[model samples]
Target: MDSLSEQQQQASEKPIINITGEKVALGPIRRDQVPLFYRWANDFNVLRTLHIPRPSTFEENLAFFERDVEDEKRRTVVHFTVYDRASLTPIGRVDLEEINHRDRRAEFGIEIGEPDYRGRGYGTEATRLMLDYAFTGLGLHNIGLYTWEYNLAAQAVYKKAGFREVGRRRQAKFMGGKLWDIIYMDCLSTEFVSPVLSKIMVPDEVRS
Candidate 1:
């Protein structure tokens, strides 16, 4: 039997959406990249909305990279580090987590760790690129995600990427000694087939 590598599959197939003038690239996380990711995960601004544990040691972060990324079964839970093409550096990561092939769906998760990287539209662009890869490259039916209501910026990014708010879980998050609502959003392949999103996402230079 012949098996297609992930890169091969992505290159040969069509994607559900392609935001113009932007591209999303992925590769195995390097040892050097681990420290970068660790720094991002530890930053209070970036982790504020994440259900992550306390700041991780470099060793702990390395373990996490091994588990969620290296051990990921390519069939489900594909992970990728988001990179800025212009600057040629990893800025963040986006993934299709908890994928269910039987159901033909998966949940989306993303984070741009560098505080200097936030609010410049890279998050949305990275997301659009991933959505295209998930729907078109992987032949999936649905992609969805959950975000806290307080994360208005992230919610806006999701909305710009074609994810529509479909439901909400009241008081679903308890972090920093407080409860917050979790909003669920999703977009169908048909709903995201158009190129309407280009207007909402434009990239900025990655901070040095």
Candidate 2:
């Protein structure tokens, strides 16, 4: 990934049509990126934070993408591949899952699989970009997510980004040598404070 300053400079030069923030750009997942997704999905280090690691075969991973594409077509979810805007590199994936039109709510998930990219501001800004789209582009009222009890860093990011803990599933998981609860966090459109997608459409001056 490029330095934050370089990412900002690149964002200014790229077409604003890219659903991008200062550090990351969210683009539709492509066929070629499926393999990368496969690699990340099967990594124990990454899945451990979410749940017990399940190694997935390449064929299975490909099938998963196929299924997701179908779901997306049905408006079940809006998924995107995360990119480092400055370097134009695919780093991970993010999605607004289980989208309900009537309820105007969705579940959120993100994975920055590239170990080098983790802990960078990419995850943080990618989250904001997703929220902007969920609230403004999709006309959603509430967005929710769940993380493992040990994912304190992710928890902090959610709290700082306006997601409040709503509940916890007691002893729902066993990981890292202890019984851990699944923490639920949510953010309402009204509670989002970032200027990200605060407006649904880009103004004419900035759009081109």
Candidate 3:
């Protein structure tokens, strides 16, 4: 291969941590991936696990991408694409949303959009990776999330990552022919725990 081509190939092969764990890696959401984003957004199964209950149009999804980027610039939101490490292919996404900088907190959510990638514990690891970034990297004190009451599996993943249920909005969402509560949970910075710390560290005044 030509020298420039070789470097490009090497870059693709190298694991970019961005945010990482054993089975998955998180990295910046690229504009070109908006098409994939739209596909996931329209997937019934995908939206079932997310806050948005209705299917989104291509234009709406595109607008969301643009808006997320804009909010990221203002430091109120951040988005990351999840990748399977073995194949280096994008599988889903996780995001820190509605970030309250003044309160040192943010809301979290994640999805494993690929059917094949589900039920493999990838979501749990990705959650921890994001928590690591939130508590240490961003210096946020609290990270919160809400899951559909029926999404017990997702809640298990959050619990494994040290989150505890703080409250619930009863019968807040009607879906799949019934109503479900919105289970609210949060983890404090002091409570955040992750193996990613072995690879990355952010210090405070005591360490300085």
Candidate 4:
């Protein structure tokens, strides 16, 4: 898929929000953005830790994009485009997946596709915006995520964003001929009391 194809998808489903911060924006992904998303997601380096099947065609990406933006099930998965605030171009994605309403939890994931965008704080800002949406806009009680043990950079990002390690899955991933454990981390609204209040207001803030 080319850039034109992505523009068309954006017209069809438009983003849910264009969250603005000092460095980046977390916006709703329109369906037209599917092609760009496909390329980023299918990159070998990007999909190294993701669980979805490898997509081989633009059509597969289109189908996935529609499902992600339209589905409203309590356990539904949602994704947002991480865009540069100044240029308004998608540079990566942040996702809240594996949501369980009864359990009041979901798994989070993020990636910066553009090499130049890495280490510039876009991931942190995008994640903060997404977590605000999950905990406040969606009324979720908890959000969680897992990362490969060696992904220390990601762990640091999650920690700075207020997540705490909760558990670890032993030898869960066999990649590049080696076994690796997965680290599970999570954050609760109750825990957000002081640190994140200025960054993202809780739902009660409005209600109160």
lDDT of each: 0.74, 0.84, 0.85, 0.76
Q: Write the residue-wise lDDT of candidate 2 on 127-164 in tens digits.
A: 88888888888889999999988888788777766789
Candidate 4 lDDT trough over 10 residues, lowest sum:
193-202
Q: Give the worst 10-residue stretch by lDDT in candidate 1.
A: 12-21
Q: Count the backbone clashes (under 3 Å) in each candidate.
A: 1, 0, 0, 6
Tens digits of per-residue lDDT for model 4, 74-172: 448887788888877779988988887778788888988877887777787777777877776667889988898867778888888788999999998
Which numbered prediction scores highest in TM-score against the true structure? 2
Misplaced by over 4 Å in model 3 are 1-17, 51-53, 202-208
* Local accuracy of candidate 1 as per-residue lDDT tens digits, 120-169: 88888778777877776666789988899889999999998889999999
Residue pair clashes in candidate 1 = 15-136
Query: lDDT at 6 for candidate 2?
Result: 91
RMSD of each: 10.4, 7.1, 3.6, 5.3
The TM-scores, one per candidate, come to 0.77, 0.86, 0.85, 0.78
